[model samples]
Target: MPLLHKIAGVVVVCAVVLGLTLPAHRRGAEKESPAGRVGNSSSAAPAAKVSGSPAPSGSPTASATPLKPIPAAAPGAAAVKANELGQIPVLMYHRIVPKPEMSLDRSTKELYDELTRLAKGGYVPITAAEFVSGWINVPAGKHPVVLTFDDSTPGHFALDAAGRPKADTAVAIIQRVAAENPGFRPVATFYLNKELFGMADAQAAAGLRWLVQNGFELGNHTVTHPDLSGMSEDGVHKEIGGMEDRIVQLAGRHTTTFAYPFGAVPRKGKWARKDGSRYSFQGIFLAGWRPSVSPFADEFDRWNIDRVRSEGKIKENDCTKYCSTAWLEYLDKNPDERYTSDGDPNTVTFPKTAEDRLAKEYRRRARTY
Candidate 1:
């Protein structure tokens, strides 16, 4: 057999093995629970955030073997902002390993550069919960950016004994950059499936707790990361609800955001939920080529929230179609269209033309920046 074919076969097998052996997380509430919260561990060493080991990579582009047709975008040659014309660029990532392993995977250096660029550009990370609530509340004069790491790969994050993000890991890189830049924030959302970062029960539980306790956010990415369009409502419920249950167990909190698996949804509609599940997400994510509009924007669609895949090197990833890197370039070339911070957290600001269309009732302190 050809060597390339053998390599592809190996990749497939590794994916399957990882999927089947991943420890379980979501079950009904009464099933069982871990021994204790993260702080209950025997170590008395105070949890002072420190640094950890070296590892990190980029988003998982492995599933979309072909550039599957993405959701229909807003009509126009120029990128249009959703509701009241407010746009927020959300960067999507997958496996953030120490070195790049695939087209979708990027190294720690790459992740660091991308994040630092945002920080330097006056961007601040915001939680999906905040986005859904229409309360951005990022520092005044800082544009809001959402960093989403899908798949929950082990390479994405790992901590040292001191509870710090170790070297080269995505979390560490993010924290390092945030610490170095006064206005940047160390916040992100992780969308997980059956495998929580390649860790077993206790380790997985700690990883989840570290995220919530440390000001990060978590979301449901379904149980096994299946194509939702093919499944019945019951199956979808099991997939989403089950994952939500597990995340609550591991993270000690419930998530109100979700990322569609394979970017597939049941009807290409606006929202979905498995009844009786502990979660009812207000923001549902779609695999992307651009950012989302403000939740309060007139065009905001809870059904198809958009996200841009991380990595600015568009040519290498067929970036024009594969991700949102082009928009970064576009923003560079067209600075005015970009979302610039107005130095106020109580109000939502955008181009003057959008003022008339603003949802007035939602604004307590409405004014131009």
Candidate 2:
């Protein structure tokens, strides 16, 4: 193969291999439970608060629904008035490695400590559906945070020297924290590609089944975890729709949520694909991929919501920084502020001059994978 072809081939092979092995090795729950079923919404609009009004009494409810709207405060009142339009931050993670050598991963101990801090600090870790549904209403003082893990890496469930699934370590951490903190039952969503779930590994399959059986929800990241913005419509369907099918098969539930691989969204370019199969400008808009500084638009696709990446070793203090209470507070006050632009996922109106530079950086980083 030519040098370029060789590199492309390698990329394709790696993607296939990683896709196939990870899910097979770390399978969890597949059965649907009340927790998994309650908050699942195919549409994102249902998740937003409606003009500071309580949802109709018959509207679907979740176990941890957001608090009902209180009367608007008097002008200049002492209370810090809650912004009814606040955007919920969906925090993302790739790995939780134990050693500095594995910087992307957080150690077992570190993961536990971080969860503990979140609980004590009053951060409610909710599933994507819950966040989207505006489910699990908490008081204005209690902010909602969505915890997500991407890639479905082996380390997420790898065995220690003693030969036990490493996921147990993370689960144990959550269990302990939940035990001590009664009201801090944090739920997490795991986005996995079909290739990640091994058809041959019974143990891994069981692990995934267990995840769904428990309170955790499974989300579709993509069948191959590719950058959809650059692919053909068929490619996008294979990546998005294919993964959704696989997740439903493996997890025994239909998955409506999606997380973009490398978080890339389509730009305002012409679509070369045939009509009827072309990308929907409206669908893209509903996907919530826009410049961060635009006025907040409530329309969104629960499947392709935005996320904030969490990195480095997971420490309790790091959680404070990663979760950024200040940032959450800012969003709380300025609910109308957008996080990404409709024209391009990478563009942001703030610090306006750097948009091109930032977009270039994003593209370069994405090309590596």
Candidate 3:
């Protein structure tokens, strides 16, 4: 109990605190593909205006805030046989109308039923950004599903007078289904174009802000939904960057994902995922017919993720083979081929026989049991 002993204790405590405050550098962070950068002849578009009547009072500007990190898996046997190297169904929808008009459209009832089925089947929704970022966090024994709505149609989202989502819209349906079924995360990514859900200038802003404020995601679908396959690289950049700037202006946040208009990529496909002055897309999606490969799988392609149409066995659109209903049934019968999580995000778990199927970059965190 000497004065010198007290001074030594204080110094040791200070040193420990300083060490804990220092940043820990991470090793082997994923590197962007060395794809050729596309030229951006277009300047950043003017900031969008979100002010108007019926705006949510004191809405916070959408800034880049990190999502709540999921805690590590608790100690116990994993509820499901983990297969981090399996396929994931990224369901795609266009219009959700009271009555289906186009082959790609689904009625409100159909949408509800499909979502109910997914919930009952042990699937949890995640944003397209999260899926492409390999941040699939769901409870153990649950499969991650990405529900993407393209074209930003009026049937997707709307705000009622009381700032509630319209009852029959996709947003409301999702929220209702989630309420009825516990553990069903009511989140999805809506890719937007110039139409902005066919709303007036100011009302559109309120809707966009609402989506971001809630758990939904805003993604780039171009200023105009044109088939990029016919456009030059500069045109592609303009389309992508223009939408990115508009999203930042309206939502006050940048979009991490981009869905190709009509799923048509430019002649130079690499430009779809390249970083420009106004935009940097982490993942680019395609209007594919089947489910996407797990983001951690060796065959996964971040720039060209696939999505199954939200339809049943129908010959009208040739979706009989690879639509949502068919794919979900297939997964049900062949559960081992689906991506079942191990609850822990830090470690990748799969069957020992599937070890070679995992991407080499993830081997350091791999666990085969």
**Please, what is the TM-score per model?**
0.72, 0.54, 0.79
Candidate 1 vs. true structure, TM-score: 0.72
Off by over 4 Å in 2: 1-84, 100-103, 157-168, 195-201, 267-304, 312-369
Candidate 3: what lDDT? Answer: 0.82
| Whole-model Cα lDDT of every candidate shown, in order | 0.69, 0.48, 0.82
Lowest summed lDDT over 10 consecutive residues: which window, candidate 3? 38-47
lDDT of 2 by residue, 1-369 (tens): 689999999999998887777743244423332221222222322333333344565667521245332332333221323232235566666665565355445666766766776677556666765554434445334445667777776545444456434554454456567878887764687777654533344554666777767677676677677776787766676566666555555666765355667767544222311124222112111222111221122233333455554443246435434543444545545544413112112211222222222221122211100
Model 1: per-residue Cα lDDT over 223-274, one tens digit each: 8998998887777777888988898887788888899987887862322543
Q: Residue-wise lDDT of candidate 3 within 143-225, one digit each (tens)?
A: 99999999999999988999999999999999999999999999999999988888887888888889988999998899989
Point to the candidate with the largest TM-score.
3
Candidate numbers sorted by TM-score from highest down: 3, 1, 2
Q: If both were scored by lDDT, which would come out higher, candidate 2 or candidate 3?
A: 3
Off by over 4 Å in 3: 1-79
Clash count of each predicted structure: 25, 44, 1
